[model samples]
Target: MIRKTFAAIALCAVISSCKNERRYDRIENAKWLIGRWENDSRAGKLVEEWSTFNDSMIIGSGMFVTGTDTVFSEDLWLEQHGDSLSYFAKVYGQNNSRKVEFKMTSSTKDQMVFENPTHDFPNKIVYRHVQDSLIADVSGVSKGQPKTEHFAMKKK
Candidate 1:
């Protein structure tokens, strides 16, 4: 009887500990990402805009402009789908207008990371808020080699 009681108590303790893990509100945690960010790089002058469209969605856009030409542009969004959230991007001239989606893997007050291993190029995307600057990174393997791109954006 004592052995059974001890086993029951251990199971209860294990369950309670699991329940104590913190649960974060993904959208609320990402509130810091809203705003306009811009930077000048070798690619061109890049401008990224983010805003809250609804309680469950944040919309964003990015463009690279240089010398009277908009070289590239993309639309981005974070939305609650089903019971979870995802990141979506539609590059103006990529994959025939099909939006690529990355499922959010983890998030915190100042950081969010998403991953889609099946994507051809970028399989991971990370966004981080750092001291009035936003740092974004996309990384994956290509041609049997690892590659990454970083965007350092300042709020405007």
Candidate 2:
């Protein structure tokens, strides 16, 4: 009876460890982000475009225009390495050469969330697909106060 009890406890430990492991499907989760998404705001007209480069990678570009002037732009990448997915951004004019990375925390068919607690401005990034529209939200703490920004985008 003691031998059987030990075997059962060992099996339970293994199963519990497996359940605690993180499992991610980065390619499948990123498939919905492909194509162009745009929005017009007081700052300007913002556009984001995403394309699939391979099974494990998606590339993105963003541009902001005000009247006839191009104000801002950035390059982004989503990639899966091993069992984790990371989101990277390289914005022009500010740290353009180095890419800031955010680690993906959760993903579903229509939503994906990433987080980087060490970042100054944006610690969390979330993307959601609702009906025909897509939503992007960024949130973080600024000077011990919480701040969040949301952008509603539509395919173009």
Candidate 3:
């Protein structure tokens, strides 16, 4: 009798885990972003062109026009991890690069937002998914200062 009882409990545990299964369906449409995007607006401008085959390796050029004297150039890479999305980028001359990892927090037909926590500046990095759309917004102060920037992307 005790053996049967233990077997039932084990089966229930397995069933519960299966019920909470998740998939990477969000990446199905992400192919639209795999190509390139360009934006040249007064508010913000950017150029990102690349080819990501199978989401394995990605190579691209990125440009950001912020202040009158600041023109930032960088590279981009996208990686797939089960149900999560990730990106790696490098500044033109910065010794260290940045890796952004976050699951698809929220998404819609025309909009999507991915979030990640940070310990450096602001605690949140929100990415907007859209054509000719903004990608990230930086809003945090290091030490009694202001730090905010907006990133936009558009298909070229």
Cα lDDT listed for each candidate:
0.88, 0.87, 0.60
Candidate 3 residue lDDT tens string, 32-114: 55566777787556777767555344456677666564488877655557766655556655645654443346666654444
Q: Candidate 1 has which clashing residue pairs, if any?
A: none
RMSD per candidate (Å) reads 7.4, 7.1, 7.3
- What lDDT tens digits, residue by residue, belong to model 1 across residues 28-126? 668798999999877689888999998778999988899779989999999875557799999977879989999999888788999999997799999
Q: Candidate 2 lDDT, tens digit per residue, 68-87?
A: 89888889989988889999
Q: Which regions of candidate 2 are displaced past 4 Å?
A: 1-24
In candidate 3, stretches whose alpha carbon ends up further than 4 angstroms from where it belongs are 1-24, 41-45, 55-60, 65-70, 92-95, 98-104, 119-123, 129-136, 142-146
Error of 1 at 94 (Å): 1.2
The TM-score values for the models, in the order shown, are 0.80, 0.79, 0.55
Lowest summed lDDT window (length 10), candidate 1: 19-28
Candidate 3 lDDT score at position 84 = 61
TM-score-based ranking: 1, 2, 3
Better of 1 and 2 by TM-score: 1
